[model samples]
Target: MVTTGHWIDSSWKLQKRVLSFVHIPPPRRGVEISDAIFKCLKEWGIENKIFTISVDNASNNDVAIRLLKDTFSMSKNLVCAGKLFHVRCCAHILNLMVQDGLSQIVDITDNIRESIEFVNRSDGRLLLFADIFKKVFPRFRDREPHYDCCPSEEDWVKVVKVCNILETFWATTQIISGSDYPTSNLFLQEIKRVKLVLDNGVNDEDDFIRAMVRKMKTKFDKHWGECNLLMAVAAILDPRQKMKAVEFYFPQLFPSNEAQENISKVTTVLFEFYDEYVAANDHDH
Candidate 1:
């Protein structure tokens, strides 16, 4: 079990290091995981400094988070009262949603993959490759009697739509999971960008795409149904975005009924955190 740490140092630069990579004995349930995390935090003497914990979607992780929240609640000084303590890993959630969507088109993908492998497997096949894949595809369809697996033009259309839908997800994952840059400040817009694509996808006239997107949206909502306020708070923190980013994107990110409510929640959380910061600063003074 690896507990990694990421923070901005006094120099205002991104700093990351592996805090602990300890072995967890069998029966790694919520209690065990929480115990491990808590021990690691205390060993580093930064348990109280923790703002949030990110983990992939799992029942045990959920339980572990709740356990940790209860433990941390003992600290009266917790910022925003530990409301932001549990962060569902964005990359992990995206992988789940994307996997759900891709599974819908397994046959389509398999056909395409097999076809590509057929053509790229050897120098002889490479010699026959046309400058454009599409141009070569038809001749391939006609020449190879055994290539019954070639995707139809209709299947290719769905592939195009799938690629378009995943473009934002790919970009967001890249942006948020970067090793060389600070990602928190960039999370707000990247997340909204993904919502935009999914929203557009569900409306796609093509049944294949609409069905796939609906599945993905269900997973998206399951994990992020309630707006992760931290994303919005991050928006407010970014000088380039601030509250306006939430104001502008909320309407599109959520259902019409939930958008304003979510926006309100974000502002409320932001002010609550600010109040805590002010109180803490004054106490320090």
Candidate 2:
């Protein structure tokens, strides 16, 4: 397991630092995970400086977050009282959404997999058989059971459409999953891309495609129904975006009624955080 930390430096620049990367032994429980995190923070002398932790949506991680929250509260009070401390990894959420949608097209995927396997058997044989195989397939398929699948022209078409839908997600994942560069400022725009693509797919004429798209939408809503406050603030702090970015993306990310309301929530939280920083600075003086 690895623990990476991100923060704004004294020069007002974002910094990414790997706090710890360790091999966790078996039966990794919340207590064990919290211990590891505490050790790393104490070593770096940033235990009290931690703001939030972003992790994948796993039951174990959920447990670990709870443990860390209890321990941290005892020493240093967290911003927003740590209500927004545990951030679910957007990439993991995207993977879950993709997997859920893919499940709806198992038959197509199975057929494609088998076709690729057949092609891999012998490239030379595949080339030679390409001409006669089409003519022979109709008769050969009659003897084969439905359980033993083969790809059809329609299956390939579905695959192509599905790939097109995933193209944006693939690109978005690549950008967000990186720690080398500042990714939070790009969050809203990237999310807008996904919402637009998914919205376009919901009206697909094919029943299977529609069903798959709906499944993906369900997962998307469940994970991203609420915009992440931390990333929202990150974007707001960015000179290129400020509050305008959130205002623009809110309508697309949420329902029409909820857009302005959520924007207010972000604005409120942003100021509350600023007040906290101001108080801390005053105390130091």
Candidate 3:
């Protein structure tokens, strides 16, 4: 079963240690859900020995935080109140990157939603796309043909975003160019931009990577327009050097844009350790 949250409690009785598990059920009733889990723990005779509560960056999970606070209010003597609640999940931030990134690109967002709809409505179409995709990139060998992102899955959004991006660049060069399709120089420019991002050829060596990093940082420092969530995500996804570009700018670079409102909302629920975890995990290769 897919699990999002789990809690463990321990107690010391002189030389003996006792432990118990608290499984936080799937979110059904908003933030109050955490309270239910805590109540269950109390009933099980698990005292206030919660070292940490790890959660994803979901708003409802934030409700869990509020619920914890409320529970503390009820039994101040029983709970420490300031127990560590770590809200750090790397996959979650990656998921958020897709949401924030693609939302800025209307074409990317529209195409992905449409593609998912097209695939879900017809099994044959899904098979066809998978077949064609495999032929295009045989390394993606899989028995059953399936779209990267199914509308039924939350992480499906990331799959769709990645596929749309990769496909758009590939199609632009091999299919669109020198074809009957009406193409513009502007389209070619966008394709080039995408290619530069995909290839990450700007940073070949230590010096080159440093130079590119400086240039990007300079651009970010000078420009005050917006955070360009898509651009930020492209940098985050850059496989070269473990997204050093992102490490250079953490909480400061992230929440600077209006597009980051949702991200901010989520981050606010996280403790300090959780934020650092987010920074470190995204920096991981």
Question: Whole-model Cα lDDT per candidate?
Answer: 0.84, 0.82, 0.43
Clashes of 1: 0
Q: How many angstroms is residue 143 displaced in model 1 relative to the true structure, after the best TM-score fit?
A: 5.3
TM-score of each: 0.87, 0.85, 0.33
Give the local distance difference test score of model 2.
0.82
Spell out the clash pairs found in candidate 2.
none
Winner on TM-score between 1 and 2 is 1
* Residue-level lDDT tens digits of model 2 in 1-285: 899889877998878878899988979887788888889999999888878888888888889999999888887678977866888998898888788877877888887687556555776645644655654444334543432456666777888988888888899999999887788788888988998988988998888788889999988888889878988998999998899989989988999989988999999999989988898889657
Q: Count the backbone clashes (under 3 Å) in each candidate.
A: 0, 0, 1
Preferred candidate (TM-score higher): 2 or 3: 2
lDDT of 3 by residue, 1-285 (tens): 122223322542212122334455555555556656566657656435443444566677677766775665566422223433333333343334334434444454565576557555877766766667633222222333543532333334444544554454445445323323322222323433443443352343434333433443333233322333333343334455233443444333334554356344323433343554575479555
lDDT per residue for candidate 1 within 64-168, as digits (tens), equals 999999888987645788778888898999899899989999999998898888887777667766644556777776766666777778888888888988888
**Candidate 2, residue 45: how far the Cα is off, in Å:** 2.7
RMSD of each: 2.7, 3.6, 17.4
TM-score of structure candidate 1: 0.87
Judged by whole-model lDDT over C-alpha atoms, candidate 3 comes out at 0.43
